[model samples]
Target: MSHHAKDLLTLAKAVIDTEIAALAALPSRLDDDFLHACETILACQGRVIVTGMGKSGHIGNKIAATLASTGTPAFFLHPGEASHGDLGMIVNGDVIIALSNSGTSEEILAILPVIRRLNVRIIAMTGNPQSSLAQAADFHINTGVDKEACPLGLAPTSSTTATLVMGDALAVALLEARGFTANDFARSHPGGRLGKRLLVHVRDIMHTGTEIPQVPPDASLQQAILEMTRKKLGMTAITTPNGTLLGIFTDGDLRRSFEKGQSLHEQPISALMTVSFRSINAHNLAVEALNLMQEYAITVLPVIQDGSVIGIIHMHDLLRAGIA
Candidate 1:
């Protein structure tokens, strides 16, 4: 677009290309050390303690959050704080994952002896595999990058990305090993949309008793329209006297019947009702009901079990419950 804008785009692309190269090389570095790091964490009874210095500390905090959310009990420990009273946080049966780009950060190195004395296992992540920390640890994950995305080579760009990726790899591997399912993930994220979709059932949000709009097969179209208006569900379920669901009459059915010039006042609802109606069970997931609604291009569904209409679900109910 402009001279300066073109230069900016070129520089941005160059940075992305550099980081892409760094990440492309990261997979080749994962060997026995990566597997051992995973195995050790899996066998660990205590929580994982992630420690690092500066920008690596920021990345470690995120890594810890990812692991903690994905079935791994983990937290980030600032290495500088660990040198002080925070060192007491490490205990027997716990595992330490230390991150240091130079492999010899003073704050991180200062806690090595204390971790050793406490009989804790250390998994060192460093840019140099031959660094002092890597050589002394039980396992090492090399996150080395040939160069930085920053043209000045001062900022930790590509290296941090590589380290974060490696941390994600470890968390995912452990998640798979533990057989972590969506339900388990939802349990950990109870307040999020994923939890709502998995945990909220049709019974939790469906309208029941008088709240559901319903009428008999012999109900006049006007009677069904009044039921729909009173319940405000835009539809009414046609049920037998014994509560057996037979069909449903929605606004679409009314429109089609009216277009045919039928006598709305005298016509029975069953004459224009949709007999092949989709239904959901009360115990089924509300998200499943939403899928059914979307598949049939309908906005409402009757909750039926054994041919009896027990409840009804509206698309708005799903939206209110955060399931849609």
Candidate 2:
């Protein structure tokens, strides 16, 4: 191998080894102090204000986002900006989460006095338990690692990963405590596929009234073909005289009939229609429809209400609505 490739491989191994050691060291560090931090943050009525510098700051931003999305109200405040006017963002009822690898970040320490005066609780995450930030905070979490993944031992690598994972641990713990559900997450992320999966009901996308293609079981195959064409769902439901669904005729049926040398206009649809079919309720989630579509390999599903076909939900409809 080339010298450059060998060097890259060594660096990668160093990073992995550093992170493994860091995670292994975490169990001993999990103590009563961590529980106290969780309790303090949970007691706060306002937001959890997160502040960190450099790589710690990047991790803190993600931590804040996870906290906010998982039911805890939180936002990131860059320590550098906090030294300026951003300190004003912290208010009463808020709790501050300060991140510093050495626990002596001047940018973080610069706002310590103001945060204290605001009567907000402080939870410090640091590698040094004896540093100024940890000493000044109400609760301190020890995220110290044996060494940095950086060969010079100056860059933040394992420390940052540990901090980020610790932040996720806090957020998820709070999420469970608050009874945050998938529906709640959907409300927070309405623009994403998860939101679509949770919020969409079968009734919203089902083809209703005359748009549903249905023909009596005794109807000629030509009549069923016309219904399928008019509905454009590539299928037609075969129903009883009282509109109760009996079976369905699809494009697959047409193909099989053509292969058998049978005239499409001659036979009754009931002779070719599938009598056994799986169906979904109108109130079921659209995600359930997606699962059914995948399992059956059928593009169109009949939505049933009170044993009667109320509407038709097509894969194309789900795809258009971003639910598929």
Q: Candidate 2 overall Cα lDDT vs. reference?
A: 0.90
- Model 1 misplacement above 4 A: none
Q: Write the per-residue lDDT of candidate 2 for residues 22-78, one digit (tens) a residue.
A: 988887887888889888878899999998999999999999999999989999998
Alpha carbon RMSD to native, model 1: 1.3
TM-score of each: 0.97, 0.94
Clashes of each: 0, 0
**What lDDT tens digits, residue by residue, belong to model 1 across residues 37-76?**
9999999999999999889999999999999999999999
Score each candidate by Cα lDDT. Answer: 0.92, 0.90
Residue clash pairs of candidate 1: none
Best by TM-score: 1
